[model samples]
Target: MKKYLIPLLAISLIWGCKKEVKKADESKEIMTTEDEGWTYLFDGKSFDGWHTYLQDTISSQWQIEDGVMFYKPDPDKNQGMNNLITDKTYKNYELSLDWKISVDGNSGVFYGVLEDKKFVVPYMTAPEIQIRDYTNIPDFTDKQQMSGAIFGIVGIEKDVANKAGEWNHFLIRIDHDKNQGSVILNDQEVAKFPVNGEAWEALVENSKFKDWEGFGITQNGHIGLQDHAHGVWFRNIKIKEL
Candidate 1:
């Protein structure tokens, strides 16, 4: 009986070691994939995987030229008219892009955007990171309307934008577990905030987003670009899931 007991304990220990080794191998695989880095959201030559917000086709005003997806605003057009969005959905991620706005142009990068056309447009479901010519754009009077702001929710301190026609880089990191997010401009940290939590709750409590159900939920949704009747170019748009 004693000999049989010893053998049984040895077998159990061996099985446990095997299971541990298998788990370690699986973890290594996951880490390797993560280290592979960001996937391109835009292919630089086509809008093959993108569409108009809540629409099946890209708008006539949006085009890809000189290897950049650009919003060509018509002088005859009105404000807040066009929007472009990615075909895929993303949750927690680090999104990076290069953007340049025309003189007095206003645009934005939006995420956590659920595609719903129940209203006149899909922007009602998402929060925006404002992109504007801070020194040249006359409409915005506050820092929150500047290039790196979380548009109306939080303001960024630095004026990190390149001149009106030069390209500027932006990085946005969204962490769903911590219920927080941040924005960086030209490799500098600009703004940070909590999402769907107390800080966000306070901001939404009295803002226009108060009654919106899907606003700032941040589970999985499209990436979007605002077309505020001005020429804006974007390139090298990429993301890595956190």
Candidate 2:
């Protein structure tokens, strides 16, 4: 009985040691470290890496105040509804941002924006994660048109958007290599879709973007923030390459 107990005790010890080591390794992997491949798109004080879509510079309407990136329409100098786009392009990445829209306001965060002026609008070349005031916007006729929708390709089931003037968190993970992506709004995972292949193409063909020039045609492009002629604030914008 003693000899049998010794062997069982030894096995238990070995198993316990292996589990402790694995937990430590996982802890290190998730620990936040400096230069963890995260790049700040909005560093609180400056819009250093961003510009107006199809333009070489940031517009005066876009401003930074209290560390928030905001858009206040010039009213007198409204440009043709172009989004604020990243000067640098990304291929596969995980993006996170926070936004608060004004009552009746509407905006969007788009990826895969092909920046040729010929397209005229960012939506013509990319997919948008809708930023909208869900309480006041009357245009949301379907789930696909609601906040956090993949902008027509698919509609999100969770309506977790906060009230206007309240902050809403968003995380968008895009992986071209895996041909998959997802959108999370206010900590609720709302949508997932194929980025490429027949599944992706079928959705495009059935949606409003079927004939739009360059829409979802590229795997890599600029990130975009739509003005939508509405007042909105964005901050804590960061991205990590996958």
Instruction: Please name the candidate that would achieve the greatest lDDT relative to the true structure.
Output: 2
Clashing pairs in 1: none
Residue 166 in candidate 2 has what lDDT?
A: 96
Model 2 Cα shift for residue 198 (angstroms): 1.3
| Model 1 per-residue lDDT tens digits across residues 120-231 | 5556777899888755544555878788988877888876778788999999998778787899998999999876777788987767678877777656788889988888
Whole-model Cα lDDT of every candidate shown, in order: 0.83, 0.87
Estimate, for each residue in 46-164, the C-alpha lDDT of model 2 and write its tens digit.
Answer: 87888888777787888999999999987787754657999889889999999999898888999988988688889889998888775754555778877889888889886888889
Worst 10 residues of 2 by lDDT: 132-141
Give all TM-scores, in the order shown.
0.79, 0.83
Q: After superposition, how far is residue 139 of candidate 1 from its true place, in Å?
A: 11
Per-prediction tally of clashes: 0, 0
lDDT of 1: 0.83
Candidate 1: TM-score?
0.79
